[model samples]
Target: MTIKIITPEYVVFEGQVDSILLPGKQGEFQIFKNHAAIVSALVNGQVKIYTDSVPEKYSKYFTKENEAKSAYSFAIRSGVLEFNNDKGIILAE
Candidate 1:
């Protein structure tokens, strides 16, 4: 499924992903392909995206030594994730 992660500043990520593990307010939730439509709040934790399409040049974009790790996680504080039909959208604050 395609997943889009966005922040107020800019779009963080947009691409195909195998699955997503999100930090839900009640508890952790996992989203797969063709998930039912819904919307929920996010908590302070890691958002894990499982994918295999890593770009080589991305390693040079970050000041940290592990810029490649950005392909999987975004430590979100408070936000919302919406899923509908075949699309998944995450809006982080």
Candidate 2:
């Protein structure tokens, strides 16, 4: 699935991802390919993006989760998430 993490000033991250773990208002949730469509409010927490390779340009925006760098994370104070048709968009603060 494709994911984009955006803020008022700029796009924090944008690229194809294998999956993502989001901090939903109710709790945490994971999204993968062909997952059901969803729209939810997010809380202050980390957003984990999992991919085999990180794009060089956007790599600076995320902190590598492991030495191999197959996973990365971005923290937010709050945000909203919407996913559909194999794509996810996050409007974050």
Return the top candidate by TM-score.
2
TM-score versus the correct structure, for each prediction: 0.80, 0.92
Q: List the lowest-lDDT window of 10 residues for candidate 1.
A: 56-65
User: What would the per-residue lDDT of candidate 2 be over residues 39-58, giving only the tens digit for each residue?
Assistant: 99999999999898677887
Q: Residue 20 in candidate 1 has what lDDT?
A: 85
Measured with C-alpha atoms, the lDDT of residue 77 in candidate 1 is 86
lDDT of 2 at 25: 80
As for candidate 2, its clashing pairs are none
Measured on C-alpha atoms, candidate 2 has an lDDT of: 0.90
* lDDT accuracy of residue 62 in candidate 2: 86
CA displacement after TM-score superposition, residue 67 of candidate 2 (Å): 8.5
